[model samples]
Target: MPTSNEAVKLQHDAGAAPTAAEAVRAIDGIAPTTGTARQVADGVWWIRLPVAAGPGHVNVYALQDRDGIVLVDTGTNAPQTLQALTEALCILEPNHGTIRRVVVTHHHPDHIGLAGWFAERGAEIVATRGTLAVAHRMLHDKTLSRTPEEIDFAVLAGMKDLELAAFIRRPKRRYADGVAMLPNATSVIADGETLQIGKRCWTAIVGNGHAVDHLTLCSNDGLAITGDQILPGMSTNLNVPADQPDLDPISAWRDTCRRIGEHIDERSVCLPGHHTPFTGIAIRSRQMAASQEAVVSRLLEHLQRPRTAIDCLAAIYRRTLSLAERAFLFPEAVGYMNHLANRGEIVGLRRGKTMVWQKQRRPRGDTIRREASPAISRPYNFSSEVDESR
Candidate 1:
């Protein structure tokens, strides 16, 4: 895609109507249709898989390697998604090489679902320790019952007894169901660690908020396999965990966006988890931060009177939510409320079992201070297998 930098250069080069490619690149970037592969960068291909759930599609990257191809962020293990992925891989097989390493961006099923499938085909699984820990746990556990902590959180989010029960009784989509096989071993990568894939050396950068220890790798030339961290035209979900009610994901997300933005410039073409490949990393980072600030402002207005996270949902989203949607989005509402509470823009009080948030009045000339990023140590030792397992 032509970045803001490229557009500037284009103006000085010639004065003519833009080509179809240039025009699309100048606009909203390029979105590769599902079941297809497009070369976003030299030796780097963007493969999009069709998803029946959220976003309608998920993007995976295939980086050319010395021995084979290094696949980043596998799509879901659903039959159609797998078929689409297989077809895309086959189309690139003649030039790109075989699968050498499957690098998972996070533990989300849509992103990591096909890791086991690739691993079975002699591809080494690679991901952050935190991601591996959660992936392994979910892949091994088959139960669908809600935990005591989850029930408590449902109540805190204003979920009624009947509603909570119905949510629990609904059919579950387990993590194991998304993977073709169990991930027996993984090569863990740390933040700032450099990995050699083909002629490129990518530095692993950790991103939070969307997922615990989300892995993002930026090459020396500025091409980034960003996963879900820095998507174009959409805000990454910042969900608060039930166990960690006080965790401030917004601060972490904002810091992560800034941190990732520092590595790339306006010319870097980032391969994201969803949507399309685009440039202007720093600009996109600022946009994401601004988007969150706008959400916070709207939320503060919604808190004119005391309101529960559930009560403010309509005001914040302005849409009717299904039971499934509520189950998926309730934690994010808590996250926004917690972010406001942490900023001192709002105060939360316990009303029996539920928590109601009220806007806080600050003195004249007083400014709200930004919260420091949460310090959560990653589970580095979660992997019993070593990197040499490959």
Candidate 2:
């Protein structure tokens, strides 16, 4: 774990470096899929299928047992994703008759989109209490469909109209806690709980940050099913949802990464929700930690000049965005900014409809530059020219 002193020192040192895009590209390069798999380890198999929106593909893992198979993180509920999962399951374990349970790592569409589909198939959907609570709240009230509720929620959080409207376009669904609606969810697994499937027993590790109650499963066979908790290529989004105003997701994510590093060894095969299964859990954890630290450092630089969350996002992404993309970017941008503010590296001041940020103090002799004015100011309009560059 990085101490506050160490974090501050690193933050200051990092500000003297190049832009975030340069640092990220130098570290992880471009995000690429490592392709899906059949069986990664003993009794553990993964199916990487594509989704219609955002981040393209998601991986679903199947733990084979004598009775049936237990699935971790079903892909989106789309027809193509469903068909691919069915085929993949049949190929992995043809003798298996039914999916006994579906463990949702979090409530993202790529992760839980097929929860209802699995429920229809009589597979019990399992998730952490926090995840389930948020899922239910978002789903029951049709929050995604209502524009006014979105604007109200965003404005309450000090967001602009364009930011709130971007969020309202996405479809949302709900799931309650305590295993009532999902079939065969005999019990809710808390942090550090052990679950038995067929002949194997896996330990559930509850983590927050990326998702409210992200669950990463570690089996005795040296395999850890890390849904979106840890990805091979890209950094997972640590979003500040409209529903949860007080949660500090960036801190939660960093701590969760450290906790995951402590629980799993370096050699344990990581079955992530998006990328290919690979070893080096510790390496990935450290990289994620550094990446987050780097984000904070970049935000600190942005705070040198007073800027809103949208301004910070545009500066960092450096590309035109869609409504859905802006919805994803705004919270993430604000989350990291908020993390820095909590660490006393940045300060926030509300100005009418927007919240502006500025650095607490100058770091050493680093000189800050003003952000260039955007050529196009239209909200949620990305031209084909910009799309080609992306």
Candidate 3:
């Protein structure tokens, strides 16, 4: 793959193609797919597949197993994605294009949508029990993610009546819209289960938040397959669903951050779901925790006066919001607001028919907690057993 960085380096320095060494240092910095697989490690290859709609491609990894290739994640389903998948498979696993097994990290549309695509072709699908359960329900009922409860929640967050009416009339986004088809069956993977892929033994370190029971694979040989758990460039969406009003995703996400820093070595390379894979995970994990906490603190200060979750959107993101962005933005804003309420920093009271968050005390604006030890520990002791449990 010709990295955008590689081209710029060519003009600045001598003509030097992207090297495995450079890719090892900063995988995300490496140019995306040049219509072929880029070797990130000895037996691991990186493949970038186009999304139906997004800024760039979704990075999928293919590991060499004894019998055939073991895929970490599948890009979203569609003819366009299938075309990209076939082209990459032709280059990486040309022997018989044999994908012996497909391991999914979570139940996100992009990661789980194409599980059936490979399963239909005989690859055994692997994912958490919760993920499979949700997939089945989504296949049965398409409009589950966005219901009247969501509209009501949005109104509680302060979305105007006109926007709410327009949104309900055009509730086009649904769970099934992202997932092409559900695999009839999946060989479920539990937390702390070791999987032998290629020459390494990878263990499934399941953590809560960011899609409950999200599995991040930590290999014995200092390699971690972090599916959206530990992305390089951006933060994962930690939102609370309208139905599960009690779930604290930020706290759950913090526990996952601790697990990554504790289980995975600092020097180990993390092959993430999006962006480039990178090393130095210990530092990155702490940075992520601090950044998230700062976002929470910022919101709490904004809540000194009563504010709806919708009103808090501007406090977090100062720019204009898009319809697609609001789908995520509202939930995450509510999640942070809920975290504050849970911490006794804010109070959520019924303002007329909807809910609004107000500060419990004078806002402790931007007071970074100082301690002898680390900032994050075991996180809040709540687990999203799944939507059913919620």
| Candidate 1 ranges beyond 4 A from true positions | 1-35, 364-390
Top-lDDT candidate index: 1
The 0-to-1 C-alpha lDDT of every candidate, in the order given, reads: 0.73, 0.62, 0.69
lDDT of 2 by residue, 188-259 (tens): 679889888767788888877777778898877677888877776566666676555435676676666665
Clashes of 3: 2
TM-score of each: 0.85, 0.75, 0.83
Tens digit per residue, CA lDDT, model 3, 250-300: 777767766766667757898888777788675555445555655665676
Clashing pairs in 3: 3-31, 28-276
RMSD to native for every prediction? Answer: 10.0, 10.9, 8.5
The deviation in Å at residue 340 for candidate 1 is 1.0
Compared with the true structure, the alpha-carbon lDDT of candidate 2 equals 0.62
**In model 2, which range of ten residues has the least summed lDDT?**
372-381
| Candidate 2: Cα lDDT at 373 | 18
Off by over 4 Å in 3: 1-28, 32-34, 95-97, 144-146, 362-390
Among residues 3 or more apart in sequence or in different chains, the pairs in candidate 2 whose N, CA or C atoms overlap within 3 Å are 303-359
